[model samples]
Target: MNNRKEKTFSEVWGEFITSQTAKGVADITIRNYHQVLHNISKYLDIEMTLDNLSKSKFDEMIVEMRKVGIAHNSIATYVRVVRTFLHWCKAENIIFIELPNIIERETVKETYTDEELELLLRRPEADCSFCEYRNWVIVNFLLNSGCRAATVRNIQNRDVSLADSQVIFRHTKNGKIQVIPLCSRMVNVLRGYMAVRGGVAEDYLFCDQYGGMLSHNALRLAIGRYNKSRGVAKTGIHLFRHTFARKYLVDCGGNAFTLQKLLGHSTLTMTKRYCAIFDADIAKNYDNVSPLAQLYHPKEKIKKQSRAS
Candidate 1:
């Protein structure tokens, strides 16, 4: 009698997702994994098995995704998800195939310039109402603190200490508690907003007109509307982050290590990329700092006189 264990592709995927959930993966991450898997299934439309999963088939799926005009970064994300899943399966002895290590990705980092930020910060009308005040403060907080939208959404009154000139991030992307020092401008804005907020310590710092906590989407949409009205292009919450990273590096002459800490990055790889993006600025600064540029140059007449003598 033949005795062998076999599982369908869907079964293996379910098990993998279950394992990820058990490991305390973020809900958004798990959802993204499920979405990528679903897309793969829809494209392949084949009965997947441990023995039948092949690199050729995966490559074909990638080609199909490209033909449909999927963004390069998105395709890379799909490839990464699939590669991780296949590695997990291999560890579980469900499949044995060489996983693709590299996926073509385009680095399309976007950031707001100082002029753009000035325009955006002034976009909100000069109204002292709760909503207007909150919106202005939100834009300032995002630009000054460089915190993620999720972090901003999760901020509570207790997390902020105006006297200390800092805010505590209870839930960060890396799952680490971080305390970011607030700039004087940001502190002033927070104090003004708090005077109007009038909420308990446990209540969220930012709220809607109805005094309810704001969602991430609410913050995004608010910014989007303001951007559209102001005629700003490529507007989003993450642009604040990119702008912060770039400004931190350029303004403060910060290195990757310090940037990694401030940005709460697990490694310097991404931070280094930010440095690369600002290479032109770095070069211009280098030109000013070079000894040749700093030293006084002799005139051509002096050189000619000295040679004649």
Candidate 2:
């Protein structure tokens, strides 16, 4: 008789989380795993033994989610996370269920126009409050670097080296350090802000009014309020990243390879989306570089005539 013990789904999930934590996975990612499983439990028995798990049960749970009005994109996200967990289970020889295909649709990414950017970039008056001034600087940083809000929140004063014309992102999505150049213009702006903000090297670069580290929601709310005050309606802080990517590719003609590194994407998959979305950028000066357009520049215009015969 076979003597291997069968592990319950909950036991396996707890083990996976522990393993992932040991691998230094981000806390947010771990939290997402917990949340997704909890939501899945709403539709079916999430604590059943690994042997009872099957793709049919997953499909039924998905149907339940749809009936209850979960966004498709959000459902897609849950599928992705759960797939990772199932893959881990397979690797550990705990259980195996044929995974379903992940069908996700690409949505258009919105970016700020030059006019909107100009409005957000406007400098505050000399007597502006610290929060106002800080928000302005934060907007500038986002536009300049295209960093995520979490990365922005984790910045330390020492991470920015104005004299060296560089900024170091120590807390990236992939948990790696990313260093990017700081333009002289941005250097000057940060220099002025830091002088006024004044704190030790260990202080958060963009701290709360109380000189404490800024939280994620606080950062988003600050940007939202700042945008409304400046008369710009769109308030998604992540749009700054999208805007930066668009401007970097469409306006500045930056290539994808460098942008991939600049954006700290672990792969070209996401970067290629930006390229495909902004593919029209290739036609911006097509006439200037077209081989036929340049080659057809004869000394005299050529015209077609009736057959000589």
Candidate 3:
């Protein structure tokens, strides 16, 4: 055959990985993919060239991955990314092996228990005057809005639209500006904090003593220390978010699609994980529509059918 542009599988895969790494995917994601490919490459006993890889090799690699305690979720992510690259290779007529067949991943639930949430929200503030007040406001806002830590850290005074009773998330994980309704408590806190904050200070709502934007790490550490001092466990900003989601879904009887939209998740499937973790009573509450209670003298279904016949 004439010379073709069919490239080696290994070569294309390497290039694809490099390109994806440059696109701002998380460091953990990059490392996991690299490690998975490296292990697969080693198991084939040879170069494990993409053109030479077979179904048997893929199966052995998966078994080894399981033996090493890699989570199914992680493996599923790897399969997705790898398959995307391999499909591209196939389009170019360069595939020697098909992508590994993996089961659909079960979602991992990460919601906080009520006790953990109460501990996080009630973590005592430091004796610092202004800092303590600001942190209280921060905790309250996080509990009410379910905003991510990054979004909470980046809140500017202008982001709060008091007239509309809304707060805009400027830099969400998906880069969407999500506008959440400001709870009355949040509005009151914001008003009080702003009354103390001078109008001339042109920066974030919560700033360091130096009048700069708040450091995400410092905020995290402060919250952690506060929790430690109170002898409460599991103190993280994410826990606040988890608490907010669970409480709102359970206590307020909110729907999944609405929660998904409010939280700015890209998919309903992502929000379903939170729903799945909720107590059975919470899920049942949403389904409790009693026709029997509404109808005092309802006709029996079998009797009604017999009478009609």
Give the number of the best model, judged by lDDT. 2
Count of clashing pairs, candidate 1? 0
Taking all chains together, each candidate's TM-score versus the true structure is 0.82, 0.83, 0.66
Candidate topping TM-score: 2
On TM-score, the stronger of 2 and 3 is 2
Candidate 1, residues 1-309, lDDT tens digits: the string is: 111125566777888999999998866688888888777786774466555667888888888988999887677777888888888877877676675765555364678988788777873555556766676788788877777887888899999999999999987877899888899988988887798898899898888888787876687887787677666786688888888877777776766687787778778886666435566456756755787866764445534345564
Model 2, runs deviating above 4 Å? 1-15, 38-51, 64-73, 274-276, 289-309
Tell me each candidate's RMSD, in Å, in order. 4.8, 5.5, 7.5
lDDT (10s digit) by residue, model 2, range 1-309: 111125677777888999999998976688888888788889878677767778998899889999999988788888888889888877877667766756767766888889998999989999999999999999999988998888999999999999899999999889889998887889999999999999999999999999999987799899999999999999999899988887888788887788899999888887766434556567778888889998986677687888988
State the RMSD for candidate 2: 5.5
User: How many pairs of residues collide in each model?
Assistant: 0, 0, 0
Q: Stretches of candidate 1 above 4 Å error?
A: 1-11, 38-42, 46-51, 66-71, 103-108, 126-129, 289-309
lDDT of each: 0.76, 0.85, 0.68
Name model 3 segments beyond 4 Å from true.
1-61, 81-108, 123-126, 129-133, 195-202, 206-220, 278-309
Q: What's the TM for model 1?
A: 0.82
Global fold similarity of model 2 (TM-score): 0.83
